[model samples]
Target: MEMQKEPVGDLQLHQVLRMNEGDGDNSYSNNSLLQKKVILKAKPILQETIVQLYSKSFPECITMADMGCSSGPNTFLPIWEVLEAIDESSRKLNRKPPILQVFLNDLPGNDFNSIFRSLPSFHKKLEEEMGGEFGPCFIAAMPGNFYRRLFPPRSLHFVHSSYTLQWFSEVLEIPLNKGNIYLAKTSPPGVHKAYLNQYEKDFTAFLRSRSEEMIPGGCMVLTIYGRDENSDSSAKHSPTIWDFFGMMLNDMELEVTTPENHKLSM
Candidate 1:
């Protein structure tokens, strides 16, 4: 696999950020309802795209990828949805479904083991759900940042991502904004420009990389958080959330510096 650059500026995201793993309360498996909802909403698009793909040309096998496929029960939802789309189209067309080759891509640190553990259930569910109608299905993991090349040219026919690209490759080393973990309405124009530049670069890289890997006529369905149409680029959804965080931090700093707290520490 070709080495990819950090998704956030120079910061290596694979090292620092990952969905919480395992079956604990914090695990992505348990807490990914919103992500799942995004995937569910994309189903109609997926179905339409697959139908068009079949109409144009029927490949012997369908190459599908779920980029940023974090380790969790939710990881295989895209695979299942895509397969269902293909199956439905095949039925409509009175044609046999194509073999399904799925690539689950995520950062190297993602809990692939958890995903692997869930594979048996995934397979069993597919069999029970589709039986002989479903063609041979092969699922594999590609551990790398999607901002870089992860597959060979013309290797994929479909790609999907949900609620992932909003994260930049890294945090800006220079804190342009005074008291925000992410872009906020209070951020200056320069800070906003810096973030927009990072986003454009990262999103461009993501598209370029995918273009190299996907065949002509391939389809990509992705969901990302965006500012409201009426809102400016700097106006993120949670403007006050960060300000509250900043206030809490300031209070903690004052508490630590107080005479009573200082004396107790000494």
Candidate 2:
């Protein structure tokens, strides 16, 4: 969707960018199988990083931020993985479990209320698994843009993002990519360049902001959906599922969009 350039009146990217949210049947919390799979694939990395960080610092409290944590079942998956890792590491080292301060971050538009309502069961499960012996863990909502700094300097111990960085901070018009939402066989050279340039700019901002927020020995685990540069950008062998979704979006655009109200709205 095309957006007006930055002026106060222009819609902010954070205001517009988000997954379907709520507790309904088709909401992100209910129908996020792909996102759940992403969390599983990154589980090993998250566990390893948690162990390493805990062993190195052994801080009384571990402050973790799950960036782009859209509200859903997948939002807390990393928390479980890391907690198990820390529990194991602590036992092996003869140390007590560290207290956890979990921050679930997303744009202001995310359905944090649904996540909040579901917290009791999550904490209950934690108690069921570790009993009262494990250090108390707390989860809080952090609403903001990841492209900007959201924490005090050197405050975060661990950071994680899954299928988040692929989205651009702003959805600008790419007139060159006619008939395609992304780079495809029919796309012109400029279309690919525009996408790559935007990705590089947004990623640089993310890294720079994160570097300041994370401590010296802090670690991060990130998983992105992407296609190989050399491979054909078709649905058959592509690693990402955007090809199918993009086609669906294009159809919707054609069906409903008009010259005056072309931009999509939820």
Candidate 3:
């Protein structure tokens, strides 16, 4: 029997997730001025667009899903923002907010305890804010990978994923004896090709699954990391918080796990 490949260690994975702090990292909060202008600015616009689409296409829709939701204070902010917009728009149509069914999805290893701990407060705030007129809010947790499938067929009205999807299942291959950092800088062609290959595969699967599970004309809003206009084609890695975590991995002497044998369950 073939031995199964060990899963990527959490510490190393965390590094990759937080690597955006390095110099030249446009993902840094300091870079937030510009990043905020181009990327952060697009979020509200996209949410509004989604709300408008829903109002026109399915004004009664209240079932939403936040895919790749990590547990934290930040996780629910965007969802709340979008919902608020939707609620306001519904008000214009003399319609009450539809009974909301929210599904929060993440990997099996995600910090669900923290998520549940924060949920009651989230619900309470919404209820109090809406007073007695609020529609029923049903929030449930769905633990699984996002690269495959997450929702019941034809169930969701709105789907959202933010700041995820830049992650590949594993580190890209670097030339031997060139050192990780050097290979990452000089061998741009190979690294980007690898990243794009994985992105296309994962992204295609993501869209396909969502298409199957979403009602026809249901809206989707996704916010992801991408290269700037000036990014050099030869640079092996883009700057982001995940790169900060990668630096930490180097300091801790951790090896990045390869992606070949690891089957991600979306």
How much does each candidate deviate from the true structure in C-alpha RMSD? 4.8, 4.9, 9.9
Ranking by lDDT: 2, 1, 3
Residue 142's lDDT in candidate 1: 94
Q: How high is the lDDT of residue 139 in model 2?
A: 94
In terms of lDDT, which candidate is strongest? 2
> What stretches of model 3 exceed 4 Å from their correct place?
1-43, 58-61, 170-177, 181-183, 229-266
lDDT of 2 by residue, 36-138 (tens): 9879987988898899899997999999999989987888898899889988999999999999999999999888888888899999999999888999899
Task: Quote the positional error of residue 101 for candidate 2 in Å.
Answer: 0.7
How much lDDT does each candidate structure score?
0.81, 0.84, 0.65
Residue 14, candidate 2: how far off, in angstroms? 1.6
Candidate 1, 1-266: lDDT as tens digits: 11122336344556767888798998888988988888888878877887788778988898989889997767887788778878888888888889988999888778899888888888898899998667989999998889999999989999888888987776654335665555667666776787788899999999999999999899898888786636554445543656787768767777988999989998
Candidate whose TM-score is highest: 1
Q: Quick one: ranking by TM-score, best first?
A: 1, 2, 3
What digit string (tens of lDDT, one per residue) describes model 3 on residues 1-266?
A: 11123657744654345323322545233343442343346667766866677577655547888886666555566667766776777787777777777788876666666667778898889878866686767778887667777777998888877777766555444324222442245344665465567778878888898999988778888888776535665554556554565566575553333353234422
Worst 10 residues of 2 by lDDT: 1-10
